[model samples]
Target: MSTIDTSKPHSARMYDYFLGGKDNYPVDVAAAEQVTSLFPAVSQMARTNRAFMHRASRLLAERGVRQFLDIGTGIPTEPNLHQIVQATAPDARVVYADNDPIVLRHAEALLHSAPEGKTAYVQADVREPGRILAVARETLDFTQPIALSLVALLHLVGDEDEPVRIVRELVESLAPGSYLTLSHATGDFDPETWERVVEVYRKGGTAAQVRSREEFSGFFTGLELVDPGVVLAARWHPDLGARQGGEEIPLYVGVGHKS
Candidate 1:
């Protein structure tokens, strides 16, 4: 297990704080406060992004996707990926991967699967796709369709990490008919505010790079995008329960089928 570092603010912990979760440290709170001060709608943005994940997972389950692999799984909040999918399809199998030790400590909350389903957790980083897939295979059958969820995650992966290539690698590993569900923070709406937000994260020892719509769309290069593709997180399949509020949250989301 990796040691829990409370010394510096972690993106995951800061996100937890944004979501009103108690799993974060004072450092995380201080950094998140700075971000909130910069963009007061940040907490709403976080909640909107989270809602997209829930709706996407349930929609995929309804479409007969029986397996899921969620990378950068943050602190467990209610209605987690597994819970939402299993509620839609009781036999759904979910594998969660996160590098955060605080998330590892709360992994138990993510394991309460339905009797007909299964769930597993991998304490690995998104940069280590091989390790995540290896552990996920223990619970998910890669031969069939699976939902690869990267909700609110890729933005934390700086350009140095080659995030697009990482997404390509993960998607290529999946079987045809699988889906990639992603939501990312974007600076297209209010660039100046987001720039300051990025600075705050970097100062707290976290690397963050909010992308533009074109850059965000590149992640789904060869996949067939679902309807209303690559729109604001609130606008994607709004009927599925995502709030279609008038305020634009600086987040882009989409679902694509690997056919």
Candidate 2:
């Protein structure tokens, strides 16, 4: 088992805290509370991002895509990607990846797949696309359509990390008809207030790089976007119930096909 450090506040744990889950440490709660004081919609954004994931996974599974690779998968909240897809297609396959040991500790909960479907978890970082792809393929078929999920991830990947290039490498490994469901943190809404929240995270040793709409859309460079392309998180296909409980969230969401 990977060691869990409770002294430093990790983003995954902070996110779990935002969602009212009990898996976070006191440090995480303190950092999350700081962000909440600056931006009360923090929790709303987290919930909305997760709802969008459910909608995106269900949509792809309904479209007959049975493989999924979800990276930066935070602490397992219910109705995880596999659960959503397997609910529609009993034999779907999902590979969940995360760099956080906190999440690795909870990986088994994320692995409870349908009797016919299969689920696997890899403890890895998003920056190393090759390692993730290599390990994930053990449970997923790279020759088939796979939805690469980067939900509420990427912003933590600062400029030095070459976030766009990392995404390109991962997408390049996919076969045609593969999908990319992504949601990123944005400063488009209440920039000043959002800056305060970002500052709080930075103080906690997490570097956050909120993106602009164009920058967010740039991640889908060579793909075809689905309907209502790249809009506010709450605006992305709400018919699947991605509504934000009546609050405006700054995250931008989109799903693209590698055709």
The best candidate in terms of TM-score:
1
For candidate 1, write residues 33-112 as lDDT tens digits.
99999999888888898888888898999999999999999999998999999998999999999999989999999999
Candidate 2 residue-wise lDDT, 1-259, digit = tens:
7798888898899999999999998899989998888888889888888888998899999999999999999999887888889989999999999989989888899989999999999999898899999998789888999999998888887888899999999999999999999999888867888778778877777777898999999999999999989988777778986456453678889999999
- CA lDDT, every prediction? 0.91, 0.89
TM-score of each: 0.98, 0.97
Q: Superposing every Cα of model 2 onto the true structure, what RMSD results? A: 1.2
Clashing pairs for model 2 are none
Assess the local accuracy of residue 144 in candidate 2 as a C-alpha lDDT between 0 and 100: 90
Q: Looking at model 2, report the run of 10 residues with the lowest lDDT sum.
A: 241-250
